[model samples]
Target: MTREAMAAFMFRMDGTSSYQAPKVSPFADVKPGDKFYREISWMHSQGLSTGTRQTSGKPLFQPKAALSREAMAAFMFRLEKPKAYQAPKVSVFSDMKPSDKFYREVSWMYASKLTTGYKAPNGSRSFGPKQSLTREAMAAFMYRLETTLRLK
Candidate 1:
């Protein structure tokens, strides 16, 4: 599933399905003519995603591109917007360090038991932040999220 689809599904699950606003759509690719236009626009408005391809001056959501683990963590973290965010001292995944872009979010995900990531053959765990998010993985994430929020 695309990031926009994930955002829209999450928004729907959060009980905020109403399209309320003078919608602000920054990406030219996701127009009103598109299928997930409103959902993508809403996600952007909520600050869950900044989209991709910004440095080129032509921002693109890359809607068809696979969503990364780090990006998913960031999305979940932003969606929650915890009352108090404290970064963990120790890293849960060997691949994720404190200096990584998704460090804090991944830390929160780990602390909350939202994800366990993938275990390597060497007995080390890797978050695989750059890997593509699969449908089953997204479902698992959403299940954990909804259960945690008691939204089910």
Candidate 2:
């Protein structure tokens, strides 16, 4: 199963835009009428894009792969907008070069205090937006969002 599919499943299950890490196997062979594919389609319908990280023109969800910061931030940004949530900080990463594609996303997550910065004693204060976002890190960020954004 792909990350997008799993995210879609979560979205459908809870009627919320957020995704929680699934505890069970989330993949199935690609085929028609499959629940997995249906969720992917559902996410697309909801405007959660399936990024162009595919092989042979097929989306590669790579369910086991860790979610990247870019991916997580993108998800949160799309999910948070309807709630009228404003990020707490403009940009949390001091080292994130302005030219990076995710500069704005990192800024939004930080401005809202919805993210964990990079390895810094001050609380991962310097987020490397390009770096991979880990499951643990994602959980922590969600916790922060629940508190700061008041969403759980």
Candidate 3:
């Protein structure tokens, strides 16, 4: 799903059925009256997102872009807000290095067993950070996250 759809889903899951759009949108692309505007705004207000980029001094949400696996990892990590959490010193996935953006979040997901990643032919695991997250993958991630939350 697109980032905006995910944000809207997350907003509803957080028990926010309604929200008022911010007077000045945090995202340059998400203006008032736009689809998913209130939900995206709520996501930003709740500190779940800060948008994808900045253009002309305004944050850009890239609402229509497909959500990537690494991006999902970041979102889930931010939503959980684990206190005093630290990323592993070494890389867990063959495709991702410790120096990569979102590496900490993806590593946290692996450490938490929220994801096992795909097993490559070489027997090493790959996180596929740039891959678009499939619906099934998204559901699995959310289910694991919810289950983890319940246990905690």
- Name the candidate, 1 or 2, with the larger lDDT value: 1
Q: List, residue by residue over 35-139, the lDDT tens digit for candidate 2.
A: 455555445445664555545565544545555677777776765653554433444566765566656666678767676565677663676555676556766
Cα lDDT tens digits for candidate 3, 1-152: 79988887677667455566788888888898888889888888888899857546778889999999999999888888878878888787999988999999999899888999999888999999999987788888888887875467
Total clashes for model 1: 0
- Ranking, lDDT, top scorer first: 3, 1, 2
Q: TM-scores across all candidates?
A: 0.85, 0.60, 0.91
Q: Model 2: which ten-residue window has the lowest total lDDT?
A: 20-29
What ordering of candidates by TM-score runs from best to worst?
Answer: 3, 1, 2
Error (Å) of candidate 3 at residue 107 is: 0.7
Q: Model 3 segments beyond 4 Å from truth?
A: none
